[model samples]
Target: MVSSISLSIDSDLDKVSLLARAVRALCEDLLGPDDQDAVELSLVEAINNVIKHGYHGERGKDVQVAVGLQADQVVIEVIDHAPPMPAQVLDKAPEDTFAFDEADLADIPEGGMGLALIRMNMDEVEYHSGDSENRLRMVKRIAPRSQ
Candidate 1:
């Protein structure tokens, strides 16, 4: 069985944290002791990306967040109205993947770590965008170790 919740809010960084908190509460309830801090951190990162990069600092734009809990996993989806990021950008591995040093941080752009962190923490991550909306869906499998 799967339980789902949806929320729509302003595309603001400050507000995104509230969304993250709400997700954390829902995840904690569904996952019980199995959910960890890393999952919460990843959700915050994704929400931050949607508010910052996805909406490009636009305050009034709408950002939608959805959380779904299944028997063995948790899924999160973030939707926004911004233009889709280039496929190549999403495909290329972060430079940090090879060697994450201060030099790499200097060379790479800021805010790029959001997706990298999401991919690192989540079991699956997918991007879908159309003329009207851009969507990021991430899933984290509930592991026995966490339980």
Candidate 2:
């Protein structure tokens, strides 16, 4: 199956849920239940990040989120007007797993985990920011059907 959808809205946090619904609808026949949840999780994280970090909670900044379904995978794209993130941060992948060490638990940071969640949930995550717009793309591979 193949399909695509896109949404452009202001950076208001209230509208984030709308983006999630659009993504879910796009993946209706493309992703299985588990994969659907992962896509929602990752997409939400990206939308929230754009609202928080990209627009700094301005609420009026423009942002766009899109989803495309392929025969074997789903692709997600997010575009925003905020400045680009550092190359190092964008290039780095999230840790394979997240487990807190009891001894250092108190030192754990408060908010830097969105990217990790996005990377962990999606099969592939990429970003590019330049020429006045920043783009984030994530891909989730569909599981094979049982024989």
Candidate 3:
């Protein structure tokens, strides 16, 4: 069986919580607890990036999230009309380990970790933009349920 849900929200940060909850509910049975949490976290991170960076903190802009569960995987797509992601960000690879200067508190970055988190959590990640629309797609593989 397949299940899916879609939500459209304004570029407000407050709206992301409710949207994440809806996606989690829709995916409840299709994923294990850990995977479910990962998906929710990834979903939140994706939308946050779209709102903060893509929309430049603008309100009332449109952001859409769609999640679908198939027999073997979960598909998540986040769409927006804001500017496309930086070329370096789109081209960079996700690192398995996080590296930062522990001794220097100011060296820690306050932002720019969302994409890395999404890429680390999801099995696959892709992003593209054209026609004034940008889309970020992520996938997580799951084992088939036993009969």
Candidate 4:
């Protein structure tokens, strides 16, 4: 069985909290505690990317967020019309995320960690865009429910 929820919000950062809360309330019963947090954070990163990289933090763009549960996997999709991700970001493989040695950790900057963090939390992440809509999706698999 599959259950899902869909909502659209402006690109304003302020509405991100409302979006996250709606997604969480819809997903809470389908995901375990850890998985719920993973989905929430991953979705936030994806949406923020669309706002930051795509729309350049503009507030007028419409962002569509859809979250669903399919068997043991949770699915999240973020759609926007801002712009496709930059070529540099598209070229990075998940394994290419910044690696910090104990000493290098102190120099790690903020902001750029969004994509890496989303990849860390979700089992699968994908992006697609054309002239109008850019789509980002993340999936996380959950342990089987104890019967």
How would the candidate models be sorted by lDDT, starting from the highest? 3, 2, 4, 1
**What lDDT tens digits, residue by residue, belong to model 1 across residues 1-147?**
789999888877788667777888887755545355657878788777777776778799898888888888998888888878888759867555445456665855545777787788788999998988888898888764452
Q: What is the lDDT of residue 16 in candidate 1?
A: 67
Pairs of residues clashing in candidate 3:
none
Position 128, candidate 4: lDDT: 85
Best by lDDT: 3
What does the lDDT come to for candidate 2? 0.83
lDDT of 3 by residue, 1-147 (tens): 687877899999999999999988887878888888899999999999999998988999999988887988999999999988889876655662257786898877676678889988889999989999999999988967788
What's the lDDT for candidate 1?
Answer: 0.78
Global CA lDDT of candidate 3, please?
Answer: 0.87
Model 2 lDDT, residue 1, Cα: 62
TM-scores of all models?
0.85, 0.89, 0.92, 0.87
Ranking by TM-score: 3, 2, 4, 1
Q: In candidate 2, what are the lDDT values of residues 79-135, reduced to their tens digit?
A: 998978767666554662345564797766566578889988999988887798988
Q: Worst lDDT window (10 residues) for model 4?
A: 93-102
Q: Which 10 residues in a row give candidate 1 its minimum summed lDDT?
A: 29-38
| lDDT per model vs. reference | 0.78, 0.83, 0.87, 0.82
Tens digit per residue, CA lDDT, model 4, 56-96: 89899899988777887888889888756787876666565
Candidate that scores best on TM-score? 3
